[model samples]
Target: MRHRLVTRGAVALCILVAVALIGYGLAQAMTTSHQQTVQGTSENSPHSGDGTKANPRRTRLEVGLDGCTKGWDDPGAGAQVFDIKNTSDRPMDVVLLGTGDKAADPHHDPRKAQIYAELEALGPGVTRSMTTSIEAGHFHFSCMPEDGPVVDGTDTNVPQPSAELASSLPSPVQHAAPATEQELIPYTQQYEEWVKGQLPDIASQADQLKDVIQRRGPNWREEAQSIWLTAHHRYMTLGGAYGAFGDLGDSIDGTAAGLPQGPNDPDFTGFHRIERGLWANESPDDLLPLAQGLSNDLSSLQDQDLAVGALEIGLRTHEVSEDIATQTLSGVDDFGSHSGVDSARAQTEATQKLVEILRPLLADRMPADHLTAIDQRLDAAQKRLDDASAAHPQTAPADLPVPERNAVRSQIGQLSEQLAEVAAVTDIRRAT
Candidate 1:
């Protein structure tokens, strides 16, 4: 009897081990498969602008189906089927991602923000529809499980689905009380109007700044020197300080949202040209203060934007303010470059003022995570500053020349990028 019992126990243990191994293998397989999909393609799915008003898409967002063609219609609610077919010679899978309550960042937009369904392994011209559903929040549709050009049985560096979409999450909000079309329509329209107002303003500003730098007349040198750096700086800060979350801090499903769409649209190759001109293609040093100022200004502008919409923007104005303050102190300690500290401090002060002016817009909307991240960046910046301070001192605060200037401006540019990424991660207002 003892011998028989031992044999049974051994068998049970073996089964459990086998099961565990299988589960682990599946999880890894899924992860590897997803990565293959992300890095595999650089093409944008074509969007059809031809959907009829008579059958307008009631869905919050429609993916995979074209607005131009009649075959695909918008989804109303619940799980939607997009009949995505890869008529192309290759085989591919469609991976679906959801955005619960997270607002889409205009920059670094969510993967789902793309117009067409995610296509994987399609040969030339083959067509198929992908099926998906809408949550009251944001979502993404991408091609997944791709068996791409492989080497050594390994698909080199294909990116998997981003962290936000890898899981199938339960909807946190009650769908029965979904935000009505009436409420969202007004905000959407308002956003469009606000966006249109800036084109001329941006062009005019860029032109004026460039002329100042070229003339090297009056204060033009200083202004011209800083123009490109400043604009990029401001753009970065505008990007950083906030992001959209799915559940606005309530649900773990919250992921960063859309890329910037209005003046900040990355697709606007024009901005890049404009950006390059601000520096005149020279190195970007004297531009630090200017760029930092821009970050401060842009952050302020976004705060103002939320106020216009009654969007209940979160009150994170001071988070960036505090970050700037903390870094100035550390920079003073480490670099002995009072110049960097002085400049950084001045820009931060502007950021602080912007926060104060826009505190009311935040109301109850901002999430805790957003606030926390800004502080983290500030803390990291301080470390950099402190390290600079403790190093062997340079003879004199060097007047920033082109090459040196470019280096500083590049740092400012990077700083701006961080700010924007944070802002993108935290701008989570929904259709409420």
Candidate 2:
């Protein structure tokens, strides 16, 4: 009886262990199956319903442009991908802007609303995509007026879309908003008139330079150089009106980069040309034509119906410092004269003037303390230039020793950072 009882107990223990092992294997299999299902869904399935796929929701808008067509008749607000085609002969750039509050908030642009995205320099017959997220609101599309002449064997003109279709296009603001919210058209007109008033001073300076160049006396070069500096500063003062100048601006102050051969290129016209001639010790006669060309360009610009709209006026304030960093401090602008600091001084002073003009408008948006600090920074930068100038008489900033040059560069860099904030604060962007 004892042996039988032991045998039964062993069998029962074996049976119990077998059942436990079976249950554990079943559980493991079930878990593996579940994990496989999840992995399959994530890796194999298209448009996984759980919102795990990359760019799960993408909206596409087909855009077609030519000389005649302007914008999409129907625009939807959301995250959108714009596939734009340039059907025109010339290269094109496109901008889509929201009608957000056009106030002086760095985080916001009231008139332009908000910038969705921009596609720039699209070549003829080429297609490109621009993706941006936008809020539900009014929006408009603009193509930068094409640059240069139309390419041969390509259509320069396209039939205008039907009037019904044209009417569907969103209406752009006829004029830029004022610094104050008082009047839009009047404010823009007033600014335009002001731009007109300033042109004469530039012309007069150019005329003085022409006279100095014509004299060719014993000190003619010195007199002409000094007058050229004055004229250059005066022209820079018109930074507020840069946009309105358009091609004329290029004819007046365009750099050599645009030309194939750079500085030595025959196409290299404007103030810098004279600068090269003067600094290279070229004869006054050799430089006279360049000087005369500059004077003539100024006079022509004076007569042109140029205007500094509200958009450009605000932009000039920030671009001045930006130019300092990219051009002046980099010593690109002073390749001929080596007076990069002088150029910087003139640019900064003019930019300061622009800031002061816009201060009242800016005051409403920016903290007074921040504005004061910017002023102080500008002053400090100017003082550094002054000190360096005093220390190194008859020496260009480019010729300064490395240490002294670095010290000046550091101050200018600091000021540039602060100046950058002004654009952000104002929410200014160039018109496409």
Candidate 3:
């Protein structure tokens, strides 16, 4: 459902490239301690940046090969701002976690620790800030560099608030302990198998589209369009496995977003390309080749290893709906077919499947009511989509009534927010 094709391998390479760029840029900016204070703001000053009335307490922590959380002292409870500076030559990711009673030493087993906030890809000699409100608890900072093992800062104990202070302090931030790679592997593997199961239907629909194009009988164009929609919808249900498909996916469903020649690019071959040709009144003969190519790609996809990364599986839980709301509903991904809403419905189906697959893992980690709310939100969004499709079978999303479109968007936006927590909870954390 993404505008451009991006694989897990590609994403890793990009991060490595970005780290190299940051190292090169900040080659001369390295310094010792890296501790700098804000001149104007005191620890007790009320900060309105994040719309909270609590005073902002600032602390600096150093991250590098030598140590992580170098200068951190025991911080007090309440609103806090941490300036995490990367002192190493390589880029690093930093996570602020609340260690529950499960682990005596938080760093030794961080998977059980709940994440309050995190900053990713903090470059060398660069200072990145994270603002969060904390309740009295055991907390620590974990720093992971590009090419080294995870390093942890000293455990910080924020004393419990007194009765009077508790009444005045903000509520504790909501967080969940992250899952480990081993814990997530089973779920990812299950999801992978489910994706593999969908391939048969997708390939079959592609074949149907090609057959309709080849017939060219009376009303054949309309029939071809319908078959194309069916095939496209089936392909879209594979939303969570997008990155796993990699370039093959691009060849099957990729849009012409980043292509040099746009839609005219030679590489623009897939469902969208076929959609354009069919809806733009191109000859059936012209579309047959594209349809054949799509079928071939789908067949090829079945043969590949089709492994879904654990991290990517977690991320796709939120991203599938996000792409639907941002790209599919917005019509940015629509070629000439004007089937954005239809595509969104298919993607919603994908989201539902992803949530179902991860429900076992999420049950204990997430609040019961939170999981129920997600289901309710997803059902509400699906009902709206179903109603829209039944009311106007072939209309564009933008051409729909404003109230209908807004209702769908509102439901989807809320759903995306709820799924974001799922992403956070299922994120695989590094353990020492």
Candidate 4:
């Protein structure tokens, strides 16, 4: 009996040893696998930035009343984003600054250039984010070499850029130089003609936007939204390229698609701020940063303002119209930051604010007959939006290729001219 028991005990001990060895081997394999997986993670991980987490990109950077961004509203608002392909042979740190003819300073109060985000040294082929918070303002983008700040003790009293220390900085973009003014001039002229064409159509586009909004059902909103977004993007881009909206979308796009399509933005309170500044009153605050981001050599931006004045022509149509209380616009400001949806939202919001300023001003100043005529136009605009809302977005995709968008661009151009008559602000009473 003792011998049998001893044999059994010996068998159990061997089995236990085998199981323990197998478990240990599996654990070791898993640990090694996990470490390797981590090691292979992308080089741009925030951790790769000196082992720190990446800061969430901001959409709004506010300094008192001043704001600036590449996007329509701000950075991440609706600026065209493309990856920086830095194949430049030079080894340098790239500094991003908002610039005009005037230089930028941290202490320099706005009404001049403003400094936003700075991305430091990025060796060739490495990528980094070009990011800043979104605010409804103007922004100019340019890159300076890392030494541009410190090379001659020029800005020495100013602190060195924090971007320099960022390990995750993206390589700065530097476009190849144009060898000839002849090559550049046609491109400039083409852009000029394209913009000049838009000033005539601002009113019609606004009317089209209203139709897209009201006549269509909830689903059709996206299609209508895209129409105005393209219009808004054009206006903002024109503003950047030229400086203000040259009275283009003044009539139809403003009050109709502006916020007449509200209840969409969730935050309903901000609407009051827009209404008070623009429509209800004419304090210089109506335009805020829009009014401020100006430089002494301001012809380009001023032309844009003229375009914007053209964009405001809709205020004439909506002025005698107290119908907005009855109209419903979705997500009036609900478009969240950085989402593609936000661009549409910002454009719509900007239009509403513009009208808010123009309507009250137009009503107070324009003749009764003119006000009545504008009201009739508003009635037509209301019907158009009603029809558009009833149509399906899928019926006509808003993202029709660039050619279609450009083709449609003509109508918006005609609309701008319609608004220009209203722009004769001989009616604008001095702000008491």
- Best candidate, TM-score-wise? 3
State the lDDT of candidate 2 residue by residue for 1-432, as single tens digits. 000011333322332232232110000100011111111100111211111122322323322333322324334333344555555455555555554442224454444333345554565555566555443354555455354332211111112335554444332211222122232235445556766787788788888877887887889888878887777866665555565777778778877775899998988878888888887898877887887888898888777886555544554566666566566667666646666666677677767776776676656545567678889988988888777767875466768889988988888766766664454434333342
lDDT of 1 by residue, 1-432 (tens): 000011333323332232232111001111111222222222222333212222212222222211111122222233333434332233444433343333434443232231212223343234444432333334434333234422111111112333454243222211111122343345434433443344345434545554564455666545654554444333323311233211211111111123266323432222232343343543344333333343343334433433222231212322333333333223421222233433343344334333333323222223444334534544554444334434422211233344543443444333433343222222332221
Summing lDDT over every window of 10 consecutive residues in candidate 3, give the lowest-scoring window. Answer: 21-30
Query: How do these models rank on lDDT, best leading?
Result: 3, 2, 1, 4
- Name the candidate, 1 or 4, with the larger lDDT value: 1
Q: Which RMSD values do the candidates have, in order?
A: 21.6, 24.7, 7.4, 27.5
Q: By lDDT, is 2 or 4 better?
A: 2
Go through the candidates in order and give each one's C-alpha lDDT. Answer: 0.32, 0.55, 0.74, 0.30
| Each candidate's clash count | 78, 4, 0, 83
Better of 1 and 3 by TM-score: 3
What lDDT is obtained when candidate 3 is compared to the true structure? Answer: 0.74
Q: What is the Å distance of residue 421 in model 4 from its true position?
A: 39
Compute the lDDT for candidate 4.
0.30
- The weakest ten consecutive residues by lDDT in model 1 span 22-31
Q: What's model 3's lDDT at 11?
A: 35
List model 3 lDDT by residue over 300-377, tens digit each: 888998877987787788778778776888887788888888888888999999999999888867778878888998
Model 4 scores a TM of 0.20
